[model samples]
Target: MPGIVPRGRRGPEVAGTGEDDSVWAEGQVRTITDLARLAGVSAGTVSRALAGNTLVNARTRERIQQLARSHGFQLNQMASNLRRQKTGVVGVAIPLGHDRRQQISDGFFMTLLGHLADELTQRGYDLMLRRVLPERDEDWLSRFSGSGMVDGLIVIGQSDQFERIEAAAAEYLPMVVWGNHQEGQRHCVVGTDNRLGGRLAAERLIAAGATRLAFFGDAEPMEFAARFAGACDVAARAGVSILACPTSLSVEPMTREIAHHLHSNAGGFDGIFAATDTIAVACLKALRDAGRAVPGHVRLVGFDDLPIASQTSPPLTTIRQDIAAGARALVDLLMRRLGGENTESLVMPPRLIARGTA
Candidate 1:
């Protein structure tokens, strides 16, 4: 008898003959149901047989496998994942609350994202990225978590949405964040100790003979704020003055802002501690434009010893946050959370990388 056509395939169903082992035509067994009917077994049996569930009798499993191969039957991964209640995907969100203009192409973010992609791919999960604006959507975290598109979430930055993330963490278990760790926060986080990093940067500047320090970058974001606080901790103890020079993370405005700060405070500060290496690089350029020598007339330091840090004309001395290790920790914590484990926050120590600038 003619074989049955699979549902959703564009074909007419052929009447089945009374034979017990009739050959299913190509394209006829496109789905489990189609394959099961041809093999004279239930859909569950076909699924178990396809999955090599040893519970299915050996002869029946072999018969089903041969039929599936002969008819070119392929399992629907989406359907299988749905049955298992998983999407096999992880969401990577970058919330731009403090700097709405910040792009994912920013050096620091790009570097971290590349590491995250590598870590996620190695663990058999696909990455779905989204750039969110918390100002526009107060429920951004809830929406992303409830969208059911991803199995877990890895928020790249806290931005200015710490409260929102905390609220979401109360409900969502399989979420991890990369940002500063507070004394008490609800969400699971894996990140560098920004406060310590800031302290290290400031101390390095002070040891380099900088009496007055200027912090370049916005201090609103929690991570940056902690870094600023750390720097303040060191500055206050050493009796050296530190000033926050708010700079944007976006490239165009960042350059312009750094130039203005340098032009306006050329003789005011002897040391500069940029919030990030990207900002430090921009500050380096601004200093060059203003003809202020790095570590000669003014000491400069940065955070996140990214690749470009060493490649700069006068290599940047910065605090190093292990991005790759952070990525691994984020994934590991998220997987643990997925497994119903209550993982604690992981704050990795930041090491000071001494290069030419400082």
Candidate 2:
């Protein structure tokens, strides 16, 4: 079915439906370039006319359109877009496993992604996800940014490896970051005020009568540290001590480290503030196994009210961030970018979720 056409009425009406799968599923394109060249014009010009480019000459454009109409070329979008100089795709760069999981999924990235996708689709653009690694160089970002692959990009997640991110942003690849801190001000950021969320968590813990507190974190992701800073400021103001947890791969490894600290300081600790629910859940399990009674011995507070947070033994008291809000914010930013508008960075507030752990 190389150049097959369905049994139908003869002419222009046939152009739109020639590629219908029922009739053309096994049809071959061979090369649209070959067809464009046969019409005595540049391939780009031939495409411009086929895609309704107003910049193309009138009579010549109509002839090109008529020629394409004759061959059923207008039936395939991929063929027409090649002439229009539009990729019809957006590249979304999200940091892989680089930040607090709760915010990434439950708070910020997930919602922003859904909204961005919806908005782009409404405006006739397709989403193209590109995972940015901590060790990627400028070369990777450049090739990824080239016009044919995607027309624009959205960068999400706060990375500990800011240098790599910075290098990529320096390319000016029509990209924006999910956060506004130094990285966003220096480049482009679309995120919420995580520091305020941290302060709010600290305020809740202090109100709970838990004075001796410890904080746990998986990595020094910017937003994670901001949460830690907010807690530290609150602890300082309350005249309480706060311990930041050392970095480790998972709950088990971190538990071993926290257990050593607990052993070293017998009655010096009472409450633990975990930056993520995953780490918090791990710490809670480890503390319980070590014969430390939760609430009765060590009250706990975790960030991101994850699904499993409530199912835990005594449950987890935590903070709730607006994931949908963040998503909307991101999509709004992207829409603005699409419309040639320059927008400032945004940081939404965080809410506290109380349960059994605290």
The Cα error of candidate 2 at residue 296, in Å, is 2.8
TM-score per candidate, chains pooled:
0.89, 0.71
Off by over 4 Å in 2: 1-82, 96-124, 136-138, 161-173, 249-266
lDDT of 1 by residue, 178-224 (tens): 99899889999888999999999999999999999989988988899
Cα RMSD (Å) per model? 4.2, 7.6
Give me the displacement of residue 173 in model 2, in angstroms.
6.6
The Cα local distance difference test for each model comes to 0.89, 0.68
251-311 per-residue lDDT for model 2 (tens digits): 3556687677667776776878788776778878878888998878887888767567788
